[model samples]
Target: MNQSQQPDAADPKRRDILRWTVGLSAGLVLAPLAGCDGGSDDSFSATVDTLPEAPRIVAKNGLIDIDLEAAYAHNSVQLAASAQNAYPGESTQQATDLRSYNGAMLAPTLQLNAGDTLRVLLHNKLPGNDTKYSSLPYLNYQNSTNLHFHGLHVNPGIIRPGVYGDYVVDTPDAGVVPGASRQHEIHLPADHTNGVYWYHPHLHGSTTTQVANGMFGAILVNTPRNDFDLPDDVRDRVIFVHRLNLSDGGRSDNLYDYVNNKNSAFMLNGVYQPTIVMRPGEIQNWHFLNSDVFYPFNPVLDEHTLWQYARDGNSFDRVFRPVNAATSVQMDGRHWPGNVLYPGNRSSVLVQASQTPGTYYLRAAKAPSSTGEEIVARIVVEGRPVEAALPSPHRLPLYNAHQPITDAELAQHGGKTRAVILAMLNKDSDLLVQPIPAGEEWFIPPGDGVSLTDTVFATGNVGTKLAPFQSDLAVTQTIALNAVEEWTLYNLNGYPHPFHIHVNDCYVVKVNGEDIEPYWADTIPLAPNGTSDQPTSITFRSRFTDFTGKFVWHCHALDHEDLGMMELVEVRT
Candidate 1:
């Protein structure tokens, strides 16, 4: 099975994935609205002592109304003090007389037991803007946006984009686009399976900007399968990781450029401070997400050990495979035994309470940039079991390999393992600039081995005048793994794009032909340069089972997806 060939960005496997995604989703359109313009970035005191009060809820006509002005602030997490940046989605503006540190709107943590009618009413009072004054990214709106329920089976009719429902709230037509004046409604069945799900803005073009500005939250689909009885020290806690750009100026100073293409700081769950304290007898579920505007966060726990529970939205059984070394794995769509949580396209880690109480860090795992901070969250396990002591420093044998499923493992699921690969591509021309608008397409040089449409590469040029444009394709590989199928991923680009898949969890089996450890994950950060010390390809394999739905595969970097490195996949019977 010598399937190895020189990495070509124009492979058939990549094209099929892109075609399927476009066919499944409609184009996004911006709705017209006039409201708040922008704001300044004046610095204020940290408010870790005072957590922003929960949002005031008002139910009107099957809609849950929320005050956009209300948000949460961590007084303890300081800029350059407790952390490098403020929280990822926290807001800085205040509409009331009470002044404190800038805060963030609490993205609702939908704790549903399935079969629940979920009505969300988001009021548009808070305006959208980069710290720096620049043209608005995505839909050019006057500070208004909506929500997109990732990985959940909800009707689009009720999930309108832009302003709160004005019409009878109808599912958008296939051609309808997300606008500034949109609203959305979602309903989930009780049997939807327990896992980690997430929500954010899906309004094309600006999804990256809106999400970067602060529009994301976690959704926990609880089920009875969460029955792992471990040591009391490993309680599950939900941790959210997001990045923000801030400048050295004052309040609403447009300090850091996020949407308009500048880079800045990263935060966890909207805060950075002392280690999160929790009882030793509880399970900590870290609901992680990489909401970085242009970067993928590789979280690593420096002084901690995490017993990963789930990935994407699926669960796994114990003792499914063996590991050998320390390998960096993408947390695309892997799961633990009970589907505790889904990290979305982002990665998450479930740290079982170790019997020994100590301090630990949840940092980015082998990230590429030195300019960004690696420590996203810190953990302090307080209660230790009487008989337990610190175990020797031993890594899980989950590196340099793809997750393997034996007959014993599949037997638990009645012979079902469903898998689907998603393809993402940067599909527009005019790099370093905007597209030529609708009905206009960029022409690529023929026989130049360059892709002009349906992809988002840096530029279509392959380092040659004949290849003057970088590959605009965002993603390029998608495959479906049956119970006995093996999946392989090839990095066909000059730059590193974080590859993520939804539905089932997989392990990296090999990187550039060398067998690594068999660790599990849902998002894999393919390194850039595609040169030595780094392989040009990574192969992964997994037995997909226990779930079915329309999920997406994309670069963990939100900006890449918004620019086009994103696509959807459906697991079916």
Candidate 2:
């Protein structure tokens, strides 16, 4: 049943039951956590709707050191709501029914500086993967996993001896099989922007299957900034939106219908409807991550304005001091209403408490067709007021926000524009029955009298055709270093598909042929259009700069990528 159609809204008896299942029962979830001993611990207790902070790992002495294990653990905070997506009568997840990092449902938030080295001992403790599904073009190594720093400009290969970088396109250097250990050494560039990003397993074939079951965390990048950067413990809030796709028996293997289901319940830090308390006139740093496999979140703070500094971990030039005598700096970088965040995306913004002493809500709508908004978090602004100034990009010690690619930069590369298509197999557009395209997953039959033949999307490396992704596949795209190119992504699928690229952020030039103000983004949602002739297109300009080797761009819908919607690329001097 749809969440809006659930009986809890009208039936007071059901509402009482849901409240018990979702709110106070969360206390049972906080018992077994070991490393989550960080953050504030203030709550009303009787009705435990208060927002709980996730366990965190902080960088010390220029390095973030920790051990992260991937295994089946007992996370009591049931991600699925009883009436919305959970199994009937199941309030808490069954033992060993889910997988997570360090046996905790709330993945540890990694707090680090821009130039720090992250050394992690990743242990894979899951049992052997079912090799029956491991085949070419479409593989699901359900028990194997690896790490991908989603939006940081780090090296795509090894960082040092006995350590791996942000590379996940290769198998031997990437995935850690059961009973295996991999030392991950991710080195962020000295100029890496201070914003929000995330870490997740990016092993091919099993990427979506694992992520859909809850296996992701926030990567909060920080830098030295005066008067703006807030403390990590007191006020920084990480809202990770992910689903616990469960079977009827509460196992995490139920993949079908959950991603496409509009009424799926999204958990906030593994809990539902947690309260976020703030004082009047006080501003707190809030970062959001959409870790869901398929849906889009349009986040809105009721009657409050959000100062948006970055999107997808790329800082914007929008936050600045007034050029003219505009005292309020109105609407410059503020999301007065809300913004649409796609899956595998992290948004960094600042939210000030309402001046009025009252109750408000942090709500989100799953796409546009939902019956109404779901209250994700309750913001209680009824404490002593404190005056806090909004941050400006001009005051930061080292602020290198996005500088849009101009006409000159595009002309250097001869204004080359490339086009790629995203679509479903002609036989099936939905995964209700099973995962499609047992083999030849790259085949897209001629639609509307056209396909990616020799004339279009035909790069020399892959040779005049599109190919599904394999770790050892040849680089399909060889981009000239420092050259800026424009790419148009077309979505011919019936549902929305988020396009994401690693290593570099892009300038969003246009959406569906409308010219918008250019902004920096690492991910974008191609509008849905089922027809190939009139597909939805998004135009973005990317400048391959600094460091590069081998990386990938794919559908961030995850399952679509896992099922062969990814392409490999290389940047060379």
TM-score of each: 0.54, 0.77
| Model 1 bad stretches (over 4 Å) | 1-77, 81-103, 126-144, 153-183, 189-191, 223-235, 249-256, 259-265, 278-283, 319-362, 369-490, 500-524, 531-554, 566-573
Query: Which residue runs does candidate 2 get wrong by more than 4 Å?
Result: 1-49, 78-96, 133-140, 160-162, 171-174, 223-227, 230-234, 254-263, 320-338, 366-372, 389-401, 427-467, 470-475
Model 1, TM vs. native: 0.54
Clashing residue pair totals per candidate (backbone < 3 A): 131, 0
lDDT of 1 by residue, 100-127 (tens): 1125444544444445544554444443
Best by TM-score: 2
lDDT of 1 at 50: 24
Put down candidate 2 lDDT per residue, 290-356, tens digits, no spaces.
8988766666677777766667776656463121112222211221112677787767667787889
What TM-score would you give candidate 2 relative to the actual structure?
Answer: 0.77
Top-scoring candidate (lDDT):
2
The lDDT of each candidate is 0.39, 0.62
